[model samples]
Target: MTRRITVAGVSKFFYLYENHSNKLKSTLTNLARLRMRKRRKFWALQDLDFTVDQGEVLGIVGRNGSGKSTLLKILSRITVPSKGRIEMFGRVNTLLEVGTGFHPELTGRENVFLNGSILGMSRSEIKSKFDEIVTFAEVEAFLDTPIKHFSSGMFVRLAFSVAAHLEPDILIVDEVLAVGDQQFQMKCLQKMEEAMSQGRTVLFVSHDMRAIRRLCKRVLFLDQGRIVHDGPQEEVIAMYLQSFEDLAHIPFPDSESRQGSGALRFENLALIGSDGVPRDEVAAGSDTILRMRYRCLSHLQNVIFSLTISSLTGQILFRCISTVELDSPFSVSKDGVVDCRFPRLNLNVGGYLVEIEASANGVLADRVREAMRLQVVKGAYYEGALPNRQSQVLVDYSWQINPDGA
Candidate 1:
């Protein structure tokens, strides 16, 4: 057996300039005043070391800005590492972003050949796999259309199909699957599984833990550009979940990653128990409340509050909207608190995330993702033992049996 990929002390640093004028000035100044320029150094990845054996599926998991994308970009040779070295043994293809390696002016059919050529495939080879790619992408009807005219889903489908059918020895996929529809995502996963069966090496990066658990035997947990954990799948995921226990209340104003109109902003979010006590952990099948405090900068009309509960791996378990679920539309003119109470949270024992959003007149006012962290403990959901991890929810039902003769 051979090592398909080896990364030793890999680190990537990027310099951020205050403005384009400053960047030009820094370049003009050369080494004279370079140290005195208004530039900041940011490390997207630092000291990452790992290896993947031939035909092994490796999953990388982390929060946003944890350097998963930076490592993948390095692996794909899109950028050079500032510190260390990486060795890849075979031909590689990457599905990093939507429409990557595609020409907006060219038709889908033309871009397929273009991308294939960029991947080092000969004309004959691309022709041989052309029909298979189109079929897999399910874009034959729009194959002749310009890529710019295709929807995001269509673009990703065709891009993934080309990468998957090119038969590269190593496939590197980022979170691009999130852009496609669920059915197409499943198809892409099946294709990756097929590639793995053929003894092809794979490096998968995704926030979806269920997919990572299903596809990869080994996992790497990254935090702030460093490899925090590298081992079995379950253990790494458990460690990742445990890291969230300390994140009780998150202030939204401090988060620059949020996006929405400036009409309303979430100030803080917390998970509380029935006793109105802020807690990070709650017993399974127990009452839990999600308290969201927001400040309205101006008068709002027909405002609705939306909440989503998701697993740590980014699987959305359930969602509740005040307008849709409760058939209630409310307005806010000042700062206040909104509480979404769950009488008996039926989620199986695990860690989950609460996402908050505010909308008015079908337009988004504000949204904060992963606003609060919640942990579920073992409780009286069942008579004997609680349900397994495979079960998403627990339901209490009585069993009835009658004799045939009766």
Candidate 2:
């Protein structure tokens, strides 16, 4: 495949100021206080070097502050890089902030052409695709109505449709698949696949692991404005998620970081193996017990205890709830322990985070988000096979292959 885009030694930094007075002062002292200004600078992207090839799909994954959006903005020409150079061999289109140029007063039909033209489509081209766009967006009845009157979902649908129908050589999508309902999301994914089949290069930035795996062949993992890992999709995604293994886990209740009402608080968490002993690392495919001790700050009624096992990236893999709407709820008024036992931990070897929550009378009493870590080690998940790669889950199944000549 031919190279479609090349980013070499690129970096972007922003000036940080305490207030308007400081900002004006810094601007005035610009060249005179160059060294001082450098100290007050925040680098969003630093020394980024990569290339996207035609017909290739690349995934960029990272934490919230890891510079993914900044990089995308630079690539889309929405902003300029503070340092280094970028080379593009083809037309580039961005889906960042899907409805960036939308006008509230413009009718949906008018806005579609406006957005299409902004995305590099000609008036004739937009005319040719008008029906398809409105049909896909499912806003036929509101075609002549102002977009401001449309619901949020309807607006997003039209915006995404106009942008997606374009035939740009390179597409940059940033967390846009997370919009709309499930069916709409699936349609967006299908459109992406169609674009790929037409030999267009794609740069996707998303936290949806399933979508990332389904579309991208390779990935780039960013951390603190730097490219921490760039490799195959599975390897880079797993490495990025596992990087949260060593976070400082405070077992006891802390008032500073947790969220929720002060009615109930979690005090500690313990993981016990099948041998009746507590341990930090759990063996995959073994029986396990999670014990959480909570303190009641006040009297509580119809309290519900919930525990979730999630990948280090905060994607929930398994959850245990005390009861459902039909089941009886617990009524507690004192500090107690909640135990959630598993017959066999069907999780692949990786690092996972645990979240515990308690609710009283259907209101959130206390919740600890990613408060603890669970490390799963190597174990016998299959009869005679030991896997080398890591995934968030493991399942029991059998496979049979038929002879080709039969």
Candidate 3:
């Protein structure tokens, strides 16, 4: 396979200032002051080495400060790395945050031409795909209007259409796709899949596990600006999520990591299986129970408890709220345990995170992220094998042909 992207010992660092004045001071400071400024510098990315083969869809995942964006910026040539080097084989286009490449003052149509020109496409080449871009965006009616007037959804649609249709050999997509509606997002995904099919290399970064799992078979998990895991998508995702497994069991509510009011606190979190035992492992089609223990120092009214199940990539799969599910809030002055049951936890085989949050009278009382790690092993979620890699949710159904004797 051909190497489309090569990142060799690439690292980036930015100076952190207390305020705007401090930043300006550091910039104009003499070498002596610059030495002191070095102490306040922040390393956004560390030595990163990786290569992307032609036509490979690479997924990058990490927490907000894990340097995903910085890496992409370096790859797209938007910024220079502090050290190391990178080589790419083709033109790079980016769908970064909303309002990245296009000028807000320019009309949608004008921005389309400007972006095409910036991508090194001739005027005729851009015009050839102009109608296609506008139609795909579904903003033909407002093509002449300044994009500043476009809603976020419209902007994303237009941006994705342009980036995907511009015929760039490489596309670097950020999490901006979340700004679009579901249908548009799916359309963009299909367009990207098509691009990859024809040998375009894509570097995708998203917190949405479903999208990453769908587009990229290989993934790179970053932590603290370093490559922590680089391998097949599923395996890397599982390892990334389980990185918190060791800390999930840490004593909760009392742990300094959690954030919430001091009114009510989560004491312990337990997952009970069908066989009347506690287990971290659950089958895909098996019944599961989440039991949360909490305590309060004084009388609490309208105490709302919530349990959330999310994928390794932070996509919220299910949420069970007390007031919404039970139709009434619990008035608790003493410690107790709350239970939420899932008759058939229809999740695909993978590692998941269980979270807990509680509020009293609209005030956030306690919140814990990744309170525990739950592993969903393979099970009979349906009569046959699982539907596909993208089918995270399993359902029981039957397919019949000629049932009506047509």
Candidate 1 structure, TM-score to reference: 0.63
Error of 3 at 20 (Å): 5.7
TM-score for each of the candidates:
0.63, 0.65, 0.65
Could you give the candidate ranking by lDDT, starting with the highest?
Answer: 2, 1, 3
Question: In model 1, where do residues sit more than 4 Å from their true spots?
Answer: 18-35, 149-152, 249-324, 327-406
lDDT of each: 0.79, 0.81, 0.78
Residue pair clashes in candidate 1: none
Give the clash count for each candidate.
0, 0, 0
**Collision pairs in model 3:** none
Choose 1 or 3, whichever is better by TM-score: 3
What does the lDDT come to for candidate 2? 0.81
* Candidate 3 lDDT tens digits, 123-223: 99989999999999899999989988986567767876777676778888886554455467678778878888988898998766677778899999999
At residue 83, candidate 3 shows an lDDT of 99
Best by lDDT: 2
Clash pairs, candidate 2, are none
Better of 1 and 2 by TM-score: 2
Over all chains combined, what TM-score does candidate 2 have? 0.65
Poorest 10 consecutive residues by lDDT, candidate 3: 378-387
